[model samples]
Target: MDHNINTKTEEETITSTSIHQESKLLGSNKSSYKQILAIGGGKGGVGKTLVTANFAITLARAGAKVTLVDLDLGGANLHTCLGVEMSSRTLSDVFSSDIENIEDLCAPTIVPNLQLISGAHDSLNAANLPHAQKQKLIQRLQQLKSDYVILDLGAGTSFNTLDFFIAADVGILVVLPEPTSIENAYRFIKSAFYRKLKNIEHQLDARELVDKIVEKKEELGIKTPADLLSAIENESSDLGGKVRLAMNEMNLKLVVNQTRTGTDAEIGFGVKNVCKKYFGINVDYLGNLEYDSAVWQSVRRRKPLAVEFPTNPLVATMQKMVGHIVAEQAEKIKNEKSYE
Candidate 1:
């Protein structure tokens, strides 16, 4: 099972073949290589689902085909946020053989060019999916034929959550301005970085070194991934170079939600700078989402923020964030093509 995009050589080939077969099923003649985006958090109630739902709507309204997946498993509620009724065949059905492919489980959303894959109506232990099952689902997600496939992940640094976050081409970590939220976000990112390194430990030939640094981080003066990398370089510069290259390739976007004051809004920048200094990771602050009564109102009304309160100021900020994300993705694709 490939845990992260950086080490998906085998999974990539399998995904490509699966995607080609799925393209014919979906009647998509253009292409089936959809960009995977995962919205995650360190804790629940950070508005991760809210941001994901609205982001999907904004992208679809902009004429991009979008699929919003509720991967929260047993705690799924993304459908409620999007005002979409759960399909009879949820993601759980895919595992049970009731639904052969995930694409067949897609249910139409109110927003045109948008589809919903609800995670509701699952078994008791849906969240604790087996390793093989999780890998299969990830591969099927890659086979989705759309411009973007957005996953609303469950909270915490659980292996399931971290794996899905790492699998995505783009990961957006949502956090509140509160101290607890910020701390949880840091833990989430740190755990993810460690998990990514562990995934490629064999190639780096530093499994023992990484394990030692993590297990006795304080004793070894390894406070962060950057510290661990420096220690590794001290041991073997060649191995350290490889680790540095991998860490540099990791890209994440941050969003501070429910900000009420100017100070709250600045939290995103602080977190971004801290990540670079401590973890040696590039975190793009995609701006903050202010506190708005309309958010809860929309929830009460069982509709998306854009639909329930189109004139809300928060909606405008979300639109700008979505625009920026789309522009960045376009630039990245262009650069990759140029290099090719």
Candidate 2:
């Protein structure tokens, strides 16, 4: 009897150790995936959500586990855009109730390897979510398990939008070729940069100078980012040094939409030149989408452009964009692993 008891105890101990070792291995694997991208623009009606949805779908179709989050709390129509109706739960439901785990709110979409975390649709409270709540939402988003997490942010330079954009691995700013959209896109980029500076305000004097530039632009219509940077440089050499470093570290991408001519296609290049010349920022030109009836048709059908019109020109543009984005992310991951 004593011999049998000893054998059983030894077997149980070995099993427990093996289970612990397996758990550690699984945890380590989970830690490897942390890429996130946020799509936003300063102006409205620039097809931000549509681009995000289609990009998420394309990535998922390519065997990636993608999560498309509708962060446009003011008008959360991403579910409608994706042709998904009556989600049993949403982000609001998770935040406002006892459901603390975000996975409970994740709704499976029609696409395999793709999931949708619908925003707070038609909810007044969602539009007015406090900064703390927005921060909490971002923290939860980081914990999500996926190869790519794309956030479709609301328009304008609201703190909510900037916070989400800054949290992302890639900040994609979408704009049309129209003058109004281009102007607003620049303002959005400046606001986003200042917001980032504020977050690291304690580490450098650049934050103070950037904030001053933002204030002057708002109050006096400085109009040119280069002029503002020059003024700051003249004020203090230390501030200028920090500003250059901040610009060097910026990871912002530009995407031009609704191109009608070669001139329209060159809008992205112009924007890139402006950012580099004035703000000393490097903006990646991720390509453009031509004006197509299929885009509007897909919207009317309540499906993503890529899904409804996979062979359209717009879809091709998006496919190329997604390929570049994926390659960039893979390179980043490889570099990180090499360093480790």
Candidate 3:
């Protein structure tokens, strides 16, 4: 944590136009795409990176080409989670001009069709990456050659993390059954929703209105996405339509991890219902990873649960979730084709 790393570079003006147009990158333009799944949570120790590593390994084991990009700039240990030591080349190398293209930084792993771009343990400033660098990374990531590119993001509501999550093909928020995890998950959702709203359109008028809604603080203030939508409608029906459409397109998903029991398993449904009620967005609960003492054994062995304990219940759950994701992507392709 050096002072230079935090404020070394002057903060540049980053407009939201690029992110606002990211969702339009459907297979309509390209026949196929390397699906980018960004995993994040508002708080640490909720198993976000572990989930990213195992899920990426699960996809690779299923024969899908996968590139796991460890974007946890603060604490980069995803390589260790996969039992792979830190690569000689990492994000720092790319920043230092040692590597020209990030695609070249891929370090081969034991699993077939799987590669990893390790985060730099030495680049403390990388956590506060400049806006230009952030955009560059996001664009280069889209060009990666793989069926799935999983971005293992750091835990927090920082705009850097949210921008990565928001610009991805799919954003998965990992939550534990614990109360603190649930609260952080909700905060993450709200922060992400507002970040997206700020870029719903380039028009100063619409952004100004969104700013007003976000700035409200009262007993019945704009406390939810639905509330913001109502305010937009009061201002102008046309803008409200645009805002609602933007909110719907987010399609934020949830994954309940480390559920300890049957009762804990029921938390996903409750969280989904509450999100829909307050956020005015339907949150799809992708699946959950049951609390397994053996998960630590797998970790101690320095291997992913999906790799070391393929038959574990959590691995089975990962398999089911992977199938669902694959099917959903296929359907999106099919529907895009029909329109064409």
> Which regions of candidate 1 are displaced past 4 Å?
1-30, 203-220, 236-238
* Clashes per model (N, Cα, C within 3 A): 0, 0, 0
Task: Point out where model 2 deviates above 4 Å.
Answer: 1-32, 203-250
- The whole-model lDDT of each prediction reads 0.79, 0.75, 0.75
Per-model C-alpha RMSD: 8.8, 11.7, 10.5
TM-score for every candidate vs. truth? Answer: 0.86, 0.81, 0.85
By TM-score, who's the top model here?
1
lDDT of 2 by residue, 1-340 (tens): 0111222223234333433333343366645556688999899999898789878876666656788898888688888877677587887875687876787778877677778898888577786778888888888888888767889998899888888888888889899999999889988888877777576555664566667766777665556656665666666767766665565455788899889999999989999998888676789999888889888888998877767766676766776787776666555555655687
> Which pairs, if any, clash in model 2?
none
Which candidate model has the greater lDDT, 1 or 2? 1
Which candidate, 1 or 2, has the higher TM-score?
A: 1
Weakest 10 consecutive residues, lDDT, candidate 2?
A: 1-10
Overall local distance difference test of candidate 1 = 0.79
